[model samples]
Target: MKKTITAALAVFGLVAFAQAEGDVARGEALSVTCSACHGTDGNSADAANPKLAGQNARYTFEQLLAFQTGDRVNAVMSGFAAPLSEQDMWDLAAFYEAQTGTVGEADAELVALGERIYRGGIVESGVAACIACHGPNGNGNAPAGFPRVSGQHAAYTAAQLYAFREGYRAAEPAADARMTDGESMMMRSVAYKMRDFEIEAVAAYIQGLH
Candidate 1:
């Protein structure tokens, strides 16, 4: 099973990877179950739930694959993702990506520190600027599959960052150990270096980013 999943991931052309893009209409139709946490339009109402709106389709699809294959360990997501076909994953990604993101209120107390961390990083600690990849507006790089962080829920972002820092996130298998698993490793390294306050502050800032 791991071999099959690994093969699919390697090519990005089997099962969920086969359909790189999907039908937005089909995705919308299939999102009924997701509406309880994420809104009908993919904007989540709760800060603890992630807002999928305007997220990169490829990145979203990768996550679905991770959840389905048990690489990522979220009980709620794993169950929902398990039954999804490649087309289903693709469609859901498309639907979420097509929706507009909803902005959350930022914690004013953390905004200044968060802004500095996000834009400049803690240079001495070797944390890199978020804008280098996430872009100036936090819209992210679509082709590179970096997710859009602008207007995401602060709590959700913080949780993910904490997960990465503490090694709760699943590690991607690298065909060559020498090769950095671009997305996964990059996030883990960054998160690992961030202090708890910096993580919270950055998440709060991202929540209100346009």
Candidate 2:
């Protein structure tokens, strides 16, 4: 299983790594407008907004493009992303990737269940272990374009999971729908089988991941 996971990640990583590099300095200059929500360093104070600090450049770039293209539907994100060029997106991604992120504590009562689910899947439900893709430490797979889950806000993560689960139920999700997962629908598939409490638990655990 380990070998298989590694092999699959390697293949995905290759594609992700091929993305062109962006100018970090230029990205920083362009980040001023983004500071209102994401902070000057990308660490958002609001739980509703995700902390982009320490996120991989590739993932950030892809999300920006998705917002612009209407693949991910958020009115605010679309508005922010609409006018930006592809290179501008890359620059912003690069800038955010370089910043540090802060984390909050996890709820002790939920830790056990969350850790179990993150490391081991719900076999009966056919759910895949998050560790297979996000890594045990939650650093995520940069080559695979997986965003870091460590230190992320629980509220934000839970919201995304719920959104993905909703997408899973849609026979044909509308363009303005809130599905953020790409064509693979991996997130939706995993989230669809998870209970609400499970999502909440894991999200809480992720907030405290180092």
Candidate 3:
């Protein structure tokens, strides 16, 4: 079953991410506006925003496309994505992917619960462990378009989990609802089964995963 899933993912990645590689040098020049929210080096100081440093290029490009197409809606991000051409997006993705990511200290009190949720999902709830897609160190599967979660802000991670869960639970998702997990809706499915506390726990764990 694992092999079958891996094969499927490879095929999907081939079709979905078949694009020219980006120019990191050009990308740096294009990231002036992005530096406002995300730091100049792609690591956001604010916990509300995600740190883009060390993210998978393909994943970042796909997200830019999603925002541009209105498949994923964010008031701030959408506007930024609107004027960007495909090459521009790829360049920005490349630039961010080349930067280093930093980790924050997790709450000692939350580590046990958080680690449990991240390394082993709540069994009764049917939630899959994060390590399935994101590796043990939160590096993520680059070829499969999984973004690196290591060193990501807990607040941002939790917000995204909430977004995924809310989108999944809606009887009919809003046209502009955020849903970037791809056609399989894997993230939505997993997040839907996760309890609120579990989401918080896992997000906290992910923040300090590295």
lDDT of 2 by residue, 31-150 (tens): 999989888899999998999998988788878877777677778888999999877887788788878888888989998888888999788999899999999988898777788989
State in Å the error of residue 6, model 1. 23
Quote each prediction's TM-score.
0.85, 0.88, 0.89
Q: How would you encode candidate 1's per-residue C-alpha lDDT over 57-150 as one tens digit per residue? A: 8778878887777556677988999999988888888888888988877899999999998899989999988888899899998676678999
Measured with C-alpha atoms, the lDDT of residue 156 in candidate 2 is 92
RMSD in Å for all candidates: 6.7, 6.1, 5.6
The C-alpha stretches of model 3 lying farther than 4 A from their native spots are 1-17, 171-177
Best of the candidates, TM-score:
3
Candidate 2 minimal-lDDT segment of 10 residues: 1-10
Score each candidate by Cα lDDT. Answer: 0.78, 0.80, 0.81
- Expressed as tens digits, the lDDT of each residue in 1-210 for candidate 3 is 000111122223223545446888888989988998999999999999899999988788888887787777787988999999988887888888888999998877787899988888889988888898899999998877787999899999998988888878564434434466766889898888888888888888888899
Query: Could you give me the TM-score of model 1 versus the true structure?
Result: 0.85
The lDDT, on a scale of 0 to 1, for candidate 1 is 0.78
Model 3 residue pairs with clashes: none
